[model samples]
Target: MPTIHLRRRLVELDAQILEQKRVLLDLQQTRIAVERELRETATYPILTLPVEVTIEIFHRLPLEVGDKMGIRRNTAPISLTAVCRIWRGIALSTPTLWSTMNISFDDIPSTVIAKPGLVESFINQWLGRSGECPLSLTFSLPQLEINSLYDQVDFSIRRLRPIIRQYAHRVRYIELDFKEDTRISELELHSSPFPLLQVANVCCDFHIETRVFSNAPLLHSLHLGGEEGVIVTRFHLPWQQLTTFEGFIDNLDLFIVAPNLIDVKCYWSGRESTLGVITHSRITSFTIIRDCDILQYLTFPSLQHLDVYPLVTYDFFESFLKRSCPPLISLGADAAGQGFAQWHKALVHVAATLENIKISYVPHEVMTSLLSLEERPWLSPPWRTLNLLPNLKTLHLSPVYGPVDQFYELVRFLYARSDKLRSFQLEWFTTPFLDAWIGAGAPGAHEKADTITGHFSRLQTAGMDIYVGTPNRNYAAKTHDAADV
Candidate 1:
């Protein structure tokens, strides 16, 4: 119906419009994909954090986390590298992430037994990634049973010795775990002074020759434990400057060598003999395990914290306290081999300065007797005394087996210190019974829970922090606990 040129122009315009529509559809699809990706990327905080902030986040991870990753090499620095290009750059530059290298021969796969060079290369690469940061190394080799594997073990040790020698100057902490039958002579590193070393936690099967650690000027903390026991005569630790020592020693006189020690935790069994008197001025904390008769001979003038189990005797502890007369701030009186009532008298000696007290595993009958209104009505409660730890802030006790009246006694005790008391915690020795009680909707469980919660609320309102729940085993173990201390 139209002229020829007009018809041709109309067809060309239609094709141009169709082509533009195709291009518009492509743009719409691309915009939708970009918006979806933007939403996902926005959800991740790491994406928005600066590189420095991200690096610090990784630094705040526990040192033990790296120790755990020693068993699985692919999870840590390696796994972190796989996240993204930016993260990979940040992780590689952060030397602290690689500074703590946990190397256990147990982690070596049997598949790599023949390839000792591979093991050597791996260690070199791992430590090399740390750049120049101070190292915390934990090297452990399992006790070998098969005599035929000695050559292979020697090969790995030979490879490792060179690396240790290279980095010994930078090592801040070195924990060595080896068996007694281990061929100590093969390593040829018995005399090396760790100039920068600060802590050594070593477990050995044989005598650790004093020459093995010639002089550690900076070394302050040492934890030595093993099955054959540590031979103190053969160990020449820098005792004069030592601040913390934890071990089981055959010779009890080793305490005399460390005058500047701040903390001492040991296992001693000198039952019949009285070791001569020893005095330390700087010691602030002491934790003694089984059979500590040596406490009779030692005096710590500055002790603030004391944790002892089955304390030699009430008389022995009182005598030790009198001799040391430390400015007592914290006392763990769990398993004192006596009742709370007897220990209460001992506390009076330091009550003027004591601030925090933890009591656990008290005999049920004794606890009941201590709290009974009728039994010791004459003796005023500890709270009312003017000279007895008026500034006391925290009282942590394990669950006591007694009546509701006995429980209320403790509440009253905290109430008396409500003005100054900051925290009052009742920790469970075992799993919390409240969990199961609340789950099953037991008849009296709600009432019991409400009563505890109400006390917590009142304490909070009165300017105290209250925690009534299961005990954190890690925190208890570090500070003090009945079973562990």
Candidate 2:
């Protein structure tokens, strides 16, 4: 029995030895893992790349993203540490990456100046990183906040004075979104600091004081939006390189001269002021939206396209065509409810070089005016007539209260007279008229239907197209009676 007990004890000893061997293997594996991690952490590359490559990669990122990544103009140091230790060190060492600052104060509450010092520190870090490179600052202030700040908004404005003065020569673009009165008063005062600014887009409710633009020699494009009472007293825009100008002025009388202006869009919502003084012959395109009657005296000698939505008398049309006598290539006008006599009076002096014409609201009385021109003996031959546009390729008519026959007659006249007629589009047809036209012929009566089909087919053969469709009926009744069906 004693010999049997000794054998059992030896088996237990073997199990203990195996357990210790397993623990030693685990310790050796853990030591190797720790050593490898230590080596990798020590060898990580931080800012080892050339500065040029870093700058190029930085430029590929958007300004907003860069700003969020800790790159800011003059004041805020970019925080690259959040990404990885290596990246953080590289971003901190590079100053040029942090030169451009985009200050968006739209959501910042004006009442809370609690973090002004922190905000100022961030701005300074970005400037310090930027070094001497020109700073691009974009300030977007929402209308609600601007209104809330009112006279008190200038306190926040004063915070930017130091940065503005330091980078006055380095600032390239200054976009101020006033949208309210708080920033309006400061615009004039801040103009003198941005000497290197080239482009400005101001959306304010106040007229820019004339003295504000007196020193802007490099300003090329200006977009001004304000109330109708804001008058532009500054006549001489100093930007010799200016090409595009757009704004809604209170009065056309304030604008007398623009020497190098090429494109001008003016929206006059008030009473039409005299535009005789605007004689910019270099203007190629002009859009006027107003309820004025003084269009005749204004001249656009080099104008190619003219779009006017006048709520005044149709006489403005005849007067402008007589005075300017431009070879207009495209013309769009709405003379709805007016007789054909008025249309003829307005278009009689129009140039024959017109290639496209769109006239809406052709009343029944104007039917005779179109037919009377066909009977004139002194008028040139149908195709060669001065009043009929030979180069006209497309004609669109939107009749208000006229018969289908009037449209048919006009189409026939244009097809017979104009050699370059290409397409005719008829829109907003009444449902009753469309039903009658579509239901004219009896079932299986193809010959009688041919009359309607022939009109469309002929248009196709002559390289002309016609469309007959009704406007969308969104609010109409869905259920229909047997009679309607």
Candidate 3:
């Protein structure tokens, strides 16, 4: 009914109205989606992050404070799942977060040794979450002598044995500190090949049938921490496969059997028996936490590190060095009543290759000689132009005895070796004189004291790593305090 131009204009106006409606519908849908996201953020903030990012943040916390005992339930990996449904999904999906567990039960903590099915359930649940990850399990079984207690332990072991057998192949490291009991055999079920087992620490005097693990291609470290000095022959270990051995054993005959053993650490002290001298070519590291002349009967040509509570007699040590010219890189020894001059006789043999020295008790002569203004003959043997401990880079002196005079000598000794020394830790700098002076306010020598301290400061400023006077490191105090003389 309108004019032609007006009619055409009206149709165009209708098309514009339809296009605007489509745009309005799209805007309303976008507003709903944005409001939904805002609600989610307000309700569960952590879930806003990708599930993978939240799981990674949880992994940084210590895994040791765990579900093995009820005491740590609040902090264990399982506790994370209980906090919220969001975290529960994240944790169960992470295998490595639950791969390690430390289970300790004995007569010591009453609450730790729980009922029959409880412990088995705890272990089963903890390990089942590990998926296919290698496990590191530290289990300390009950060391009970009471007949009643043994019954409880037997039941627990029987129930847990199947769980252990199922997961034994996944175990990479396991520590068994169990004493001999009826349940000990049940615990020793590595009778099945632990295909992934690499380290085993066993504390038992009973004949350990480790022969079962001999076929385990990856098992290489064995530690026996029994007190009875269990004879090596009694342990049917996979000696040929082992590269590291620790614990107490006086019998040196094991050296003959362990051709591949490269690291040996043990304690020895008793009647020094005259045994046939045995030599090993592959051992590169050896340590004795207790004093012994165990070195008298054994030798290692490939030895690179020697640490001992006491190297014992100089004659014995010198003789041992003469027989086996090891390429020693580190030396730690305590002078067991041996004089500095005598100890030096044996020490010079390894000076050529020694790069680290940790002397427990710095000999009186050595301390005095270290402070000498001139180079002493003791430090410079005529045999070679280089000084003693030529290549020494790290030195740890447990305690320097006598008075502040010996304490002052430390700076001089360190300066003497400044060319090569980069790290130094003097455990204790206290002496009777320094203690007395410090008690009296140290009036006259305050400036001198500062200067002496300044020497250590100067060394530190020169980029050398130096530390002195650590708390409670006073090994100079006599143990038991029996000798009041």
Candidate 2 structure quality by residue, lDDT tens digits, 13-65 = 99899988899989999999988776556554324567567556655554333
Assess candidate 1 and give its lDDT. 0.65
RMSD, every candidate, angstroms: 8.3, 9.9, 11.1
Query: Which of the predicted structures, 1 or 3, would earn the higher TM-score when compared with the native?
Result: 1
Best of the candidates, lDDT: 3
Q: What would the TM-score be for candidate 2 when compared with the true structure?
A: 0.58
Tens-place lDDT digits, model 1, residues 1-485: 56998999999999999999999999999999998788557756577787888877777644332332244332366667877777788888878788877777754555564665777677777788888889888778767567544354332455667778888878999887766555444455455667889998877654646345555688889887764345566765577777889887666556677777888888775544355667778889988777556677788889999887656476677778878878999887655464234565566667779898777665566455444532343667542232366768887666554332344554445555666778776654544322111111112322222343344454565467776555563111222111200
After superposing candidate 1, which stretches have Cα over 4 Å from the reference? 1-45, 61-75, 144-158, 183-190, 206-208, 269-274, 336-341, 369-387, 402-404, 427-456, 467-485
Stretch of 10 with least lDDT, candidate 2: 476-485
Give the residue spans of candidate 2 off by over 4 A. Answer: 1-106, 109-114, 117-138, 145-155, 160-174, 183-198, 205-210, 213-215, 234-241, 253-255, 269-278, 294-297, 334-341, 358-387, 394-426, 429-485
**Error at 230, model 1, angstroms:** 2.4
What is the C-alpha lDDT profile of model 3 across 192-277, one tens digit per residue?
66889999887754554343454477999988777767577766757788899988776775687788999988877454655688
TM-score of 1: 0.76
Worst 10 residues of 1 by lDDT: 476-485
Predicted structure with the largest TM-score when compared to the true one? 1
Q: Whose lDDT is higher: candidate 1's or candidate 3's? A: 3
